[model samples]
Target: MDTTVANTGTEGKTWGGGNQPLKSSYGKMMMWFFIVSDALTFSGFLAAYGFSRFKFIGSWPIADEVFTHVPFFHGNYPMIYVAFMTFVLIMSSVTMVLAVDAGHHMKKTKVTWYMFLTIIGGLIFVGSQAWEWGTFIKGEYGAVQTNGGNILQFGKYETVDGNAVFKRVAVSDIAIDAHGERVEHERKNGLWFVDESALPAYTVDEVYNGLKANSDVLVRTQIINDEGEKTVLSREESLNQIKNNGKLVVQGANLQVNEYGTSLFADFFFFITGFHGFHVFSGVVINIIIFFNVILGTYERRGSYEMVEKVGLYWHFVDLVWVFVFTFFYLV
Candidate 1:
């Protein structure tokens, strides 16, 4: 039965042979409607993120610093790896479309090969996302402090060599327990797990002393020059001399984040990106099923590979969502 009809004598009509305006099998049409609604949901999230950016006014975490890491390297190179991952995802969408085209022509072998490529692309994307999450959860350069406990960033120097210097300070430079060890929960007794390796650098005494030496450093969350590059505050200006001066000592969750940075950003970043990644994963599974069905000649006997085309719609939509996620979450 030729279910497709061209220019039938009926106006404003699309039956199954002629789709009746917006009619298709319940599954296919419903998929489109569902996707449209979900897109709006994601847009809401992105918009809320933008609102937060405006609310912060002067202080906010710099995206470049937060998301920087080389794919495989000794030195901390950043951004290039995740950018490559974006390309990988877009290319996978292209492959999935090609598979759909092949299925339309009943070319079973072509469909199988392209579907395989699509699946591999999805796997690589998931791995890259995991790497990105790991890097974000861990911060860099540390922070500046005031007598009252407020933090300041060292973005460029008021006077370069006066007291502002970017050096790897140690946690011992900051705080030391009475036992001469930095205090933290015992990993063995922790309920789930904790990253002890990510312990802070520098001791309180070292930070205060460093602050005392640098008189010009300001104790705000982050520093912004005309160009907006973020710089860490000098040790002497921030911690050494600044204790007893009024500073915002944000702790726990609040301490975790602020206009300069926040733990909430990290937590939400991992959760949202992780959920979208899981969707790509499931899409790959559906692709594999379609791939084997083609190879096994199920479609050849069934006379149409519409199933492949259906799943292709889903795979491509997943790629589309990632594009938005990347732009809003990383770039902007």
Candidate 2:
């Protein structure tokens, strides 16, 4: 006996075997699934970062001191460029909303213009992020790694507005190069198969000597005191620390060493921000494809602008993720 159920006009029912579920297209449902999964992934990454930072809360790099850079400017302007990038990305989301609204109205020209603006905003944000990565890796104020893997920075206390402010002193500004013959250890020249890393700008001895010569500059340890400022050593202690505990001259940030505090901070920064940057770049490419499709009247011929709405969903998700990332990494 065959047990087949007959269709009784259940195509538009809630549990009916239809393409649209919950009044949403299959494409939109899939997009929502992807966004939810991606959000979980980001949450896991951020949670891991939070735990690690808590483990090393006192030694973690300060965001303001680390990101005090602006394009083509020399002065220390904390969070200026990052703020600009966030604003641009948020505005792009606004433009995406306008594009989706225009698509609903079947206004192809308005949709095209809005999409174009969104693409431009994404490009600018991506470019700015790349520059920020470069600046982060290059580093600003150089430091020395101690024997116990602690970072020892050179700085001085200055009175600004009746408050004491710590000013960073670059290693190059203090250390006098000894003109020593430093050579890269190539695989061919060395006995081991692996090659060593490049030499730093100054030697430990040069840094020590420079520290001794500079009386005003003091040594700032990685430890944060009760007042939330890095513990600064006196002149005698500074000279003794450089003479006895200094291990190597560290310049920039990498997988191994970080001039700005712990290497773990740099690791998370690169991984999380790089992942978000990749998303932004992919969104930009997808928007370009959709923009051309709009110009060619693809959605217009289909009598629906749902494609624009779908892409807008993705763009808005990307923007929202960046907001969380910015808060976690920069503000918090």
Candidate 3:
């Protein structure tokens, strides 16, 4: 006996798997669903960042001061490299769009070239972000952390272009470390498994003495004033704070201490940006896979270029997410 079920009234209806409700293929629709879910995830993270930044509005690290390094030429070019990275990512999205358009026209040569450009753009962006991470980890000017966990940056007030600007004073320029023979705490020497990070380049005493010796260099407190800038203390106040309240010398950014400002700022920076960077890197890998397949004429032989369109959706979503990330982290 054959046990074949008869087709119900919904056999040819949208309820069956045969219908394209949104005028898209099953794969494209699923990609859209994934993109929507991922977007919500990013929104949650950025929302948390917004709330934290709002709570600590005053002492937040200034983006201009924080992202002031270029690859080779470095002279306080604030936001230049970051802007370039943004531009590159946006351009990659543009190239992806071109590739999708070419795929629609069945112009394989055009698709190949545009996809190649997109891959190049992605590589450049990922490399630039890695360089930025390195620069941020290896801080430019060292700072002294107060007993209250405040970051004290040394700078001098200089008149430039008819306005007074805060010029950062390098620790090496101002601090003279007389004490030598500093050793890093290790597990072998102490707890048999516990280990500590290397000591800072300068001791608190050295920074204090440097503050006292330099009359021009003043301490810029983390607190922001009504003028929308960090409150630069008077010379006398600067010396007094470092002499009495200075606890440890912080060199770069980490989970424990941040030479730039609050430790929470660095924590969020690392977590959020690192997550986004991972996404970008993943997209690049996927693009490379798809790129190779295109060269092999996989989609061409299948009589459909829908794979390019599907990946383009993901690439565009990634680029859109970066725009919001840029606004929150750098512009805002």
Candidate 4:
């Protein structure tokens, strides 16, 4: 008996494998799947961050205080630079959509230019994020790490128009070096070939002496009160705390210690933002690849610009993720 595959009348129908589900190409459908899975992953990360922040609500670092730096300007402008980065990323997404539209119209020149601008915007955003991370790691106003692993900041309460304004005092401004030669332990000089990290800008003794010299400045605890501000101690309490409890001068943030209130804040900030930045960088690279293809007339030869559309989906997803990150990390 001879047997051969025969298409019945229903062969051209949905159940007969002739239908394209969701009217999407195989590549586009796969891209959507990946985006969905990745979105869930990011959601989980943000959820974990939210739970962690809630757990340490009182000691959590204020986003406004922490991310208050621009590229060249050196004043306290809270969330301004982050807002700029967000704008750049969103504009890049807009350009990406325009490129996709140009591809649909088979406008090779327009696609090339738009894709180029998208790539540039992504690069600028990535560079801005890198600078922000560098500034975060190299903290502004140094704080003291207590023996119990608490971060104690220095600020003075001033009355302006009958209202109290807290003025932050930098450790560098107030710290005076006493007569001592403090040497960092280096690998070359240590026993067992051990290596040691670089020393901080000032020693704890110097900070204590500075606090003693400045009667106006007081120690601020990480604990937040009902008013959502760090608890400020009295002058005598500040002196006693620094003199007895202060152990190290923490100048910046790291995996080990953060000058900011809680180390958890720094951990989540670095992890979530770094993950999002990596996605942006990856999208930039893919855009570059597609951009060269557009210049080479690859999609034109194929008679379809679905490649641009696929990558456009990815770029939009990245931009959307960033909006959520900005909301959770900066605004909230």
- Per-residue C-alpha lDDT of model 1 across residues 198-233, encoded as one tens digit per residue: 333454454455444544433434545566754444
Model 3 C-alpha lDDT per residue in residues 1-332, reported as the tens digit of each score: 01111222334456453456665665677899999999999999999988888998988988888988888895878888889999999999999999988888778888899999998998899899889889888888989999999999999989999998889988878887786656788888788888887788888888888888888999999998998889999988999899989999888888899999998888888888888888889998999898898899887886667788889999999899989988888888
Backbone clash pairs for candidate 4 read none
Clashes of each: 47, 0, 0, 0
Q: Per-residue lDDT for 148-263 in model 4, tens only?
A: 99999999989989998998989999999876568888867778588678888788889998999998999999998899988999999999999999998998898788998788
Off-target runs (Cα >4 Å) in candidate 2 are 1-17, 187-194
- Each candidate's lDDT (Cα)? 0.62, 0.88, 0.85, 0.88
What is the C-alpha lDDT profile of model 2 across 164-219, one tens digit per residue? 88888999999977885677888888877888877888888999989888889999
Scored by lDDT, model 4 comes in at: 0.88
Q: Which ten residues in a row have the lowest lDDT in candidate 2?
A: 1-10
Model 3 poorest ten-residue lDDT run: 1-10
Better of 3 and 4 by TM-score: 4
Give the winner by TM-score: 4
TM-scores for every predicted model: 0.72, 0.92, 0.92, 0.92
Off by over 4 Å in 3: 1-17, 161-163
lDDT for model 2: 0.88
